[model samples]
Target: MDAGCVTAAHRVSCHTMNADLFKPTPERGPHQSSGTAKNARNKPEQSKPELAQVVTDSRTGRSYSKGKLLGKGGFARCYEMTDLSSNKMYAVKVIPQSRVSKPHQREKITNEIELHRTLAHKHVVKFSHYFEDQENIYIFLELCSRKSLAHIWKARHTLTEPEVRYYLRQIISGLKYLHNRGILHRDLKLGNFFINENMDLRLGDFGLAAKLETVEQRKKTICGTPNYLAPEVLNRQGHGTESDVWSLGCVMYTLMCGSPPFETLDLKETYKCIKEVRYNLPSSLSPAAQKLISGILQKNPSDRLTLDQILNHEFFKGFTPDKLPPSSCVMVPELHPPSPAKKFFSKMAKSLFGKKKSKVEKIPCEEKEDRDISKLVSGIVKCSINRQISYKTVGPSEVTSPTGQLVSSVPLEPTPAEEESRKSISRSFKGTMASGTEPCEDVLTPAAVAETAMKVLKDCLTAMPAANRNPPCLSRPQSFLWVTKWVDYSNKYGFGYQLSNQNIGVLFNEGTHLSLCDQRQTVHYCLTNNKHFTFAANSLPEQLRSQKQIVELMANYMEQNLMEGGDLHCEEQASALPPLLLQWVKTDHALVMLFNNGTLQVNFYTDHTKIIVCKSSDDSYLLTYISRERVSYTYLLSMLKEMGCTSELRHRLGYVVQLLQHHTDA
Candidate 1:
């Protein structure tokens, strides 16, 4: 028989071979032998009354009302039972007397109850009181409403890396506790890792648990879910804490890869594979994950990673949320760790500016030209104009107008009058923001800003020359603004970026933006792209507190985990406001960010190459490129246009333009 059949028999009869569990009892027919009919008639009738709705404990004389069935195993059925007097609920496992009539079968139930009731740990399922009636034995356990990891795995075939880390930490904690107490959870699998309503994991199902024994005296019983069984147990050597660790590895593999590593159509094949430590590690798994799995799944039981070693593995060194949201039971969770940086910055801010003296300034829809000009300067128009002029040499046919209409092919060189008009627009835009005196009615709207940026990038890519045979070596500028670090958690929260000026910004998935500026003492929030708000870091409004927290989490994550992408540095400048992200586009190959301060950044995925274009304070265009080696070089756009760049930089710029065009088309 296969391991499944063996497990079924073990559950039904406490390891006794029982073929009757797999098939129904046959009914006697007219042709049946008279002796057989007599034997059948003498046997007790299997049918019985439905279990009493109200079960009274004979020992304690306590009455309980049974609710709906929770689950069932071969030897018992579990129900949600409430104490009639106290109105308290419990998960009651009801095992019928008929199932455990044999002395050894009854001993198994007693052993499980005795072992489980003595356990007390946060990760272990709580054990309540137990009692017996004439017809059933009721064992109460902690109620876990969300069910088990098995249910979650069924809903989400595989979990993300961070989530895997989150769950594995808890599982290892519980396993370590058991090991410390000289006990073994022989059956370790997704089905046994119960999840409570609070999203906390509790290791339950101790039916197969046993006290640790010396190797010579250990019970060589091959009992556990077949797919998770250790080779030593199958070889009848003995069960040890290492066997449980091996099973834990299988559980981890099942949760991460969506199936147990040694699962096979034939149970024998599975056992064979386990003995040989044969399994395929998918390339999709991170290197840390692969290493951890391999470390724990070693063929020799002694070679397997201990619970402590597993917890300290490199895989766990990554971001593991302290807790998971309850929604994670059915869907992916949007988890944001409490920001460590927020507290540090808050303390520093209090020392620099007294807590009572800090102020919050909320800009209204209509403000003075100077006040609004500050907002405009920290907004999108500057970068749009710089990008527009930087690629003015592109032929009209290849350029897209700000309105997204295709330009007609014509002599693309600008006439003197047109050149003068372009210069006038730039000067006027900058002068109004600087002097705060000019009332500019031609302010670009959010939609117009996005369109203009797209046009400028497309034009630049179309006009750039083909890649050169060698990289260009030229004297570059000393300083410029660009992204030094960034992380894409777009699957949950958003895309986070750190500027060379020590400013951090997160372009959220919901179309809003939050930024930390002024040495992280001030916060800037934008909604619907145009409406902006500012707050003292320590005194943010209740409505924006959650977003501020999320930005801080991203900021802390990048500060600790990610290295700066380039060496170019721009020291913090004294400004009333910081630049806000106007628009961001993500492609399979790269992430493109556009800022109101006239900065455009494109980060490529495959090689970690980056291209940044922005206007310098000198009314000149600057382009910065960070190569795959993380070396940074900054040049005037005029220089690049005249001297040309190497193929590496040229191709990435072309890709950014293509992505913009595709985004516009979409």
Candidate 2:
């Protein structure tokens, strides 16, 4: 009987093995049918289909009958799910409990959501909804039918000007919108820029935006892409929107130069180069482009050109959208919480450029290195004119040799007509102030006034010899002549620069000096040594806008540039000059002061000697011209080779200079 039971158990085990492999079923055994039934009942019934069903978003009253996995990242897992209610498709990012269970992680995600929910702009990606499920969190975002900038770069190898410009303008616009609202998108890079199917670019992943109560407070954090990070950010003294501007500059430089301006195989070296702040822009870049780069990359944040300033730059002239694109066209991205990536770079940048401990006290002014800057200034004053010691053939018979001799067979002497002209010119100007009501602002002491009058008289008397001379004589009207040129330091706006070495366009009226008082209403003595100009407003009902204050700011900036020994060494060989004319121009909220006096202006602007190639693929083209402001010169240059300006206005402005005439006449 025991053997019979054992045989029956063996037969039952064989049946169980077969059933487990294929399908579970009841099988008849010789004598242990009752035992098999008891074993099956004790084990338990199979699970019901409903028990193994996947959970749906029932809280949102949304259901997805068919869902599939899409992608995964460090933060979340994305899935392609269908909404059964609307029969619409959606991409859902599911964050697992393991990821956001920590307080810090949850806080970051929440911050990101809060930022994305409110921060809306055309070039930023949009976030729709956020919620939590049993085991994971869900963030629904708009599906973008486009590729990342990296993908585009990989596919296209590089970008064309049009493509680069389009994306840059979009990015700038988005950043402007953010900055205007007092937010800083801390993470910016080419990878953050996404291009859609329509080839329109959108800024994505605003996980690092920091909102500040004040404009100055915006730069409290040190965060950004390594390659695109600014030096100030690395130093961590405090950063502002200027950081973003720096990144934008890097992007632009990459667009033009095929890589980031400070690039190396090693990350540390790359950052070191950035801190060193040295770059070699291709020589073929336009002056406008160079000006843009210089302004954006300035070490001082306040000195760096603002968004409005950059938009008006001449480099962007070719790409500014004809019609202003709406702000809503771009996607609004969710804020990304602080992550390991952010922490890693922030720490690296800090350690690299952080302030080093010093055991020595700073040197006092007396102990500081003596540069004798005044000596340099004197050099500038002396070398202000073209007084070349060597002489070449200037005109046919007007040859004055090195020996100071008349090589011709004639002894040159003033004619009777010249003598009479000289006598009349000597007595021309009295140089004394006309009798008038002495205003409190321009009041001069009797002795001081007399001294000034005497000096004026001396100047007029000294100049009589040159003014009285007839044409063809070497002597001519020798007014304290100088030319000042205007350059666009920031082109995103229409801000013009007043560089003394270049030519600004002709002005309608030149300004005169006026005595300005201070807040005390005290009549202070004139102190010209400091170059301080006090403004006495004739009319005022309100305070000044920062842009209006830019006038004084620019003057101070120019003074600083001058005091620091500005970038005039390259042009030191040419004649230096001061402004013959001063203009105080106000347009809307912007004001510009023009001083037209300098040799650079005469050579490049007035004479049209410089050839500015607006676009260039290489540096060879950039070496062609100097920076000068002459509206007419730029206009005439475009059509010069076709319509010969010399033949057209042959008698009007006289000959257009032999060298320039050759270029235009060609």
Candidate 3:
């Protein structure tokens, strides 16, 4: 959106999947190396992929058992693998040596590893470790199973001005981290950014990252995704960090307009439009947002606003990073997490984009890939849960994807007022910090301050007497705040994510304890019974009371497993329910049910879906919720979804109910 927008800072929490890179349409077979000779490449010629359940990492010497395929793109395929030692599941980017055959390609990977290893920031994806076997290089990454900005924008159309700032503030913070370390991401796109369960926007896919010895040393590499590429890169001019600023402009525009400004079927046509600085600046954007976009999209690299200047812009008046979740805590998720289906959020992210699961292209037949996955449940929920890109027009610019897919684009007439608009918003601040440079009053934004304060508190808490300490419980990292948003929309109690282990939401917040709102923000799910939670008791017919039982068990299980820690594979958790009543679910947690009478129904949670046994008060016999003869699995799932519960949650409950209905309880 070439129009105006504002800035605001908020906390986020979540995980991610892919890196932003061009998907090369390689015609070669899996065993072939296209660019480099098979014999001379770094890979061992005869060392084929072995059919083994476990593979040892050449770097850490740790072995990870392979799980399901997460996604495949560009040069590699990512897999869900369990660290045999820790039993902690991670996403492993398995890049065949066939893909890294070229010297330059190999160096890029090396540079990526080095750059990722040296950096640590909340907005950037955390790299755990990496190693190479004879056939492939395994890059172990923090598994982020959330929507990318691209996925969200495609569904919702565009973000509101406040939401724009909400995402952009973190993007800037992440870039600032990389810039400070003298690393040039080189490639920045909607696909490269992800919102974790925390709601924080993360800058990921550093495969094309570059390292500069100093800020002044410019690199003349003409590499980047076509749409987001800066003009300087196309012209073969030596470029530095300023190039990233241009891509950021594209990102901001896309967020506002719901489409990239310069996409076309032909790359040359796209480049031409960008070079000419043509765009239909939407009138819908606030003056501040328009100014921000126009200021950064300058054709000349030197003419764009610096990161510091952008942060200080009037658009960011209410921006506070403290509201955003810390990235460090969002990393290292628990094992065998829930699937991130095409979850969307327009008018409740509208309809879920049910993308077909394309199989991971290459798997050894003798060695099988784990197909055991939880039910795929996604799509944003209300308060009408929902969800936007970029620039220059070429004859009422028509939208197009990389593969020549034609889509609608917003076209604007090339008006003189728009030209003047562009000219009016020229860079307000230029160049690097110098001897007489103006000191930014906002150099330490609220988020930075809060982060620092939290660190100090952490250190102090470490030294405190165990019995005397009560550290504050924070909320989970979230971007869209879906669960909270649902609570607000559905007027129900919220559950799912927690800011931290100790900080689970308290359920009695709705009306019963309106005073709780006075204490802190209202969360959808609250601790109705300490670890137990219930809906806000909104008294609405749509409230999923059964969901409370499901979530409580889920929460209890998550907490217990968390306390146990390391190498605790979720599958190893013994099912408390019997096999006759067990159910397989795709959610991060399993839903089990029990009954003593119509009134005191008990629900249980398991790591995976399985028939679990219920322990009685006297510790003697198995129990069932016998109050009502049979609760139809189909009816329950329908009501759960009708109440705005996620598909993952609803499906888990269905599995156990199905078992109870069909098996005829003994």
Candidate 4:
């Protein structure tokens, strides 16, 4: 085909040209003839009516069956093809023989294939075999089912900072490999960044790629997508590794801001913007992101950040996940880092116990007592108490009931210090008590509390009828303890929750619990079910600072991003010791948490519904249900057991029971 009568096949061979190749005469560059540009625009390119179902290799005698079209670019059409004998899948790029008729065009294709086949890197697309027949040239490649970043960008207009870091890191790795090999990609855009099924990024599309040359020897070709072209390339200064860096900056900008930095209505205007190194930095971008973009998009190629320098930039220091979920391609991903508390505790454990059990055993008794205080606080050792005798044997014949009321029990006398400690604990419990109830004369151990709560829940679940319909909404007091807002950062840190009373708590992954209470002025930390320490938030020990920062971060995130789960309200207790989360279990459908204060809560994932069972200050079991509509209803647990609940609540209760049973059994 002649230049003026270029067909789709011919266009494929010259795929490195600008996007304006099909534009009308007036928009053509001054170097192009008007008549030729008009003829190229007027001629509609042709494509084969249908891809051949079976294609055979000329020499190897291997046959392949083409499945579906993967994508089409200016150079070739990619399809899913499987070798009939081996049944191995491959992403095969098919170029019609007619496309590479010209000697130079054929040479370009040959150069791409040779260069790509020699590359072997984790981040670069794996090149397979290539063969040609009379009809077309087929180059087989590793199948990347996830398509490319272009599709992801189209689906999600913008990506999170962490996500941008994740993709950029891989891109840089691949770019560094090519640069180390004295190669310049020349073209770097979203469409060239392929994603595999594993969510790994594979740099592909080397149509405009070239070997690096000294400044004087470099070819001054205006090739590459217009929006991504570096100013030096447009000015005929020649393509270099820096040109690729400039394009990378553009890719980053596009991923974060949802559009190329130098893009404009007209092609010439875009070139003007690139030449001037001009683009708007949206205020919405993070400071690190803004700084990185500015550093990479320098007017002078040498001034731009190098691959290593870009990787070390502050923008990359953020939480880039080890791997991304496939769902992230179409939507925002829910990413949670390991909790700071978990990390802190782990470090402390390693320092105290060493890595081996032999080392732990070798520790001197005195030193162990001094350094292993965390073990005491972790609540692994339990003081076994018989359920029947727990309430029967006490200092007084009267025992505190679940409702904080005095109940008949065996009586005994208490020492003055014991009485004083009891009074202190009673005062702390007063904040969550119902009106007219008296504080228990004794403190219940965390284990006892958990056991009691579990038993109550188990009984309630067993007695409650199956859910065939919605549960009846009972009108009762609205005041109850429930999670108003929560965030799962369990992947890194832990699960965080904000109580209706404004107490923020995190059940860390390491089984430790930290809570911000007294309007966040006081910090309550629990190492075990019963052992805990209370501190003035500002006076936290140096070792606990990291955990504190993480909790604060989760609190701030939830406060700003999450909506309240229900309308249930409880007055903030500025002096109360918040309940400690003893154990938390996460299943596919829900998160179940058991508190040391005899409270059981289950939050459903499918719907923002919640079930909270806690004792009322009036000595009765209270069940609070938060509906998906952010409305709450409180009912007596006994009443629900007798009247039965709706299927929605019933199903959740069943799941909670199973979780509790598993926890107990384990």
Candidate 5:
């Protein structure tokens, strides 16, 4: 086998790599174009077999006739293709295996597919299926004939408030769906924001997407264009869904003012402006648009307006998200460097410097609460002081500065804040600290223990375990008052409450701002009211956020234990989508698709389900391929059964039984 070609047998050896290999190290020069397949790659369709080139999917045996090149990007070149059997059209993204042979790159591709698979809304781009061959991976997606919003933005330097509102509503809807599903679109820019022929803005190019499996989860990767990055992201402070809100504010500003609020000639100045949270609200804009943008452009992610609030703003007086029609798309003039629809590859995060053609300059996004220049500088100082600088030993000798002056082995005296941080960590894990019997000098090398100690301190700060950990469910036996009433259960095992449905919403809404996943998905019920309530989330962190499904799960769990039956049957929700039978649900680990399932309760990305698409007018459906993990059919069957099934679903279930029985009749 070739040195670069990955074999399944050597998979483990492939991932244990040098730590530095994962750093955002920019490729020094022009990228090497590696796809050499004469038929699958660059050759024009006219020169290929017959009138058009034909590509067959090995997994499903479906065939697509390649048409024209739609655009090109860092990892893949997209083309317009026609499904021969259905005569349907799509944009196929072709990525060579060599491009994703490495573990991290492969992980990225898998995540992108997973995220795209779970997201389903009128405003989000629809992902169909992914087909792979030995040399390349082909991703099938909805064909948006209008190219992207960047084209429109470039053509019309600034849009009228009405036009901005038109696009804003659609964008927000898609974002709301993503946030509800515990996913974040880290990268948001006009270039990656696409629109279909129906003038509907569909968010796409989720190469920087991530999942928030639990409520306490937060992401640290500094992805997204420098210009569109939230302040917390730049500060290397943990970030969540609110970061996307900040980016949306920047995009909203560009829609009204021709460019991002703080557009500088280069990234440094933009970053500086963002750190200070400096920007001017255009007086010429409508009061509603100005007020909304200003609110969204707030320095603190906590202060930003929620998507629901934005939707209800005075600016959208006559416009409602559901009422928005699919009008013919308005194609604007194209921007510089040709196609503005540049998507991400694992290497995109490294495209900030030197010679890559894609190394174009970036703009800055709206940011956190008002940051004093001193505070910004101090934050940098704090980051530098705490960072773990890797050290290697040549000999057990005294450390020295570059000037050859010897350095002290002991830790420096702590400042008041540092002392506080140490005290807090000490309290959290008092039993783990050493007693006075220990030696005066610490035995661990500074380099050897620096990384580990910092991780502990970080975990202490969040009051949450490390990312990979599934900490035991909250078990505090403490009690608290609910308004004026006395709830007997003060300390609960999980995050459950004892209050009325109305009161529950009132209390949950207070200080519980919308946030990224912060805890495991569990249902908490109020014994007093005998009802479960869900809180609407917002772009603002700590605003009310609760899931109705959680209560449903709790209800099911209780009923399941009561009966002698093995599993509890799903009780249909009065407000849920009109359920339909899953024409087919793939049991394999690679993909899961349910056809003709009516509108979903929510767009969710989890082990239980990653909604590919709701029932379609064409009656066709799509799904995502699980690469890193595989789920069993029995588990899938039980999960769906617990969630409840429509008559049609049972109909299909009977079809399967009959199909099995028919074999015996023959």
Candidate 6:
């Protein structure tokens, strides 16, 4: 195999050089004669198979008709061939198995063939046919008119935001299909990505793909571009489908920002950067784009966003390349490099005389109010800390600095102001901490304790457990005062809320913001004094997110149970409220109504002879009678006003009103 061939096989060492490899003729050097120079300049690039003269059609075993080569690798040569049989041009890849002596080479080729054979997706490169001739094996594929994404990246310098969205979506769609079928394209990089004539993407070369039924079954073999490899892969640890997601994220950064995130001339330095998980988002990209990238680049595979999540991102909304601005006028960060997008190559320099002086310094700490308060209360408590350094042999060693001396020190006492701050921190961190331990730490300094406490508070606020947290439902709980007073005067209530309705210009708006399946989707609801109310459809419960559907479903089910021969009670305002259980009402949808204790409920017109039970303690559950036909936003708003709803209810209704305004204006 040629040294230039980038093989995806896990065991195929890219480090080996084949002795039989062909090198560019020396006569074409820059100092050569004018004729030689012209020939050298015109000499076809090794990667461009379309420029190579056809020797023979390996598939037919007959003298080849005229066509050009499109791509080439070590053991194989691919040409854009005009099939004499059907007069159609197709890409034919020719590889001689005997010439490929690299370990796992056959396995790589077989994997590619098998993966292509079983998978059928619009965005993936299609395998049309395969067979062997006397001298080589031939695998025919669909012809791609445009160059590799690498070539496009070089030519355009950097892709615009819209172009990034347009291409990434096509690739992710193909990947989603592959993942759904239990396959992982272990090697996903810009070089293997093809752009078709229609400006659509075609994922190419599945040589390193694996069939993964379980997370443990995923690959641990290291085979990917150094710049794009995930941290887990570089550390020689096992990796899964999430590794591809990380690589794809690198590809996305390249497309949108014009360079792989972790890039430097120093190989070890680059590796260290990746290992430490360092990447910066330029201000040129939108916050949403940064957030999506951050989610994809999460270090823990379990936390990374899947391909489907990328498709649903708001960043790709209305993306199209036909609308791209001129190349010279393209907006990009000033830090982006000049292109022919250079590969990550080694340029280590040997110092002739001596090493340069080091200027590294310790990271300085800045003192701020919230930070100080947090540190004072939270700093070293609950955190694993050893006061003294010990030079022990085999048993155990105490924490120490490089100087090898005991480093025990007395913890400072907090100032009166910081002590007051500690009181609040104790309340915040107490919930999630193991039972029985207080925030008491003897050694922490006043400022340090305050800062630590703030940190603990921040962690608590960010990682609140679902059961203990009051989740933001599709809408805020209708004010208890508003509901009680309104329900007393009216026997019949009627109103409808549209799903994701966001066009009106109203003061009240209600909805749920949830993170599900590593993606974010919103659900909405509109409640009014008229007992008539409508909820937006339900959505799936995603990780670390509030699902309105689950809330509504639990509410409705409980309401039905109460109406059915179940118990019911409207306890005193201060009494313990009923526990809310969120049920799955529908995919991408859910219902919310009153549920007393464990019983369920269903709300409907009484003409059908079905009893309706209402539970007052279940604030989590609210009843809504959905109209058979989707209700318009304007009518819903008018109903709310007619019901003489309070200002608080009106505030929750603002979101629906905004939706109405958006549509009417549109």
Top candidate (TM-score) = 4
lDDT of 1 by residue, 354-421 (tens): 75654577666344334333321101122221111111222222334232433222223555644453
lDDT of 4 at 85: 46
lDDT of 1: 0.66
In terms of lDDT, the poorest run of 10 residues in model 3 is 380-389
lDDT of 4 at 161: 91
Model 6: lowest-lDDT 10 consecutive positions: 481-490
Q: Residue-wise lDDT of candidate 5 within 263-293, one digit each (tens)? A: 6775678778988888888788888888888
Per-residue alpha-carbon lDDT of candidate 4 for residues 1-666, written as tens digits (9 for 90 to 100): 001100000000111112332222212211111111113234555665455656788687777756556766554678777664454678998888888899997998899899999999999999999999888899999988788888888888899998999999999999999999999997788878999878999999776789999999999877877778888988999999999999999999999998889878777787899999989999999999999999999999999999999999988878889999998999999999888899799899999988656533476755643433222210111111110000111232333423233322211244564344335333322221121111243443333344566687678777877655545656657455667787767557767889889889886654446788877888876542223456678866544667888999999999999888878788655645676554454444466666645787877665667888888888888878777777888888887877787655665565555445333322
Sort the predicted structures by lDDT, highest score first: 4, 1, 3, 5, 6, 2
**lDDT score at residue 377, model 5, on the 0-100 scale:** 11
lDDT of 2 by residue, 206-234 (tens): 55676744545444455566667788777
Per-residue lDDT, model 3, residue 440, is 41
Evaluated at residue 403, the lDDT of candidate 6 is: 28
Off by over 4 Å in 2: 1-55, 64-74, 77-93, 213-221, 319-666
- Model 6 RMSD vs true structure: 27.8
Residue 232 lDDT in candidate 3 = 76
| Reference-based TM-score, model 6 | 0.40
lDDT of 1 at 140: 94
Better of 1 and 3 by TM-score: 1
Q: Best candidate, lDDT-wise?
A: 4
Better of 1 and 2 by TM-score: 1
- Against the true structure, what is each candidate's TM-score? 0.46, 0.38, 0.45, 0.48, 0.41, 0.40
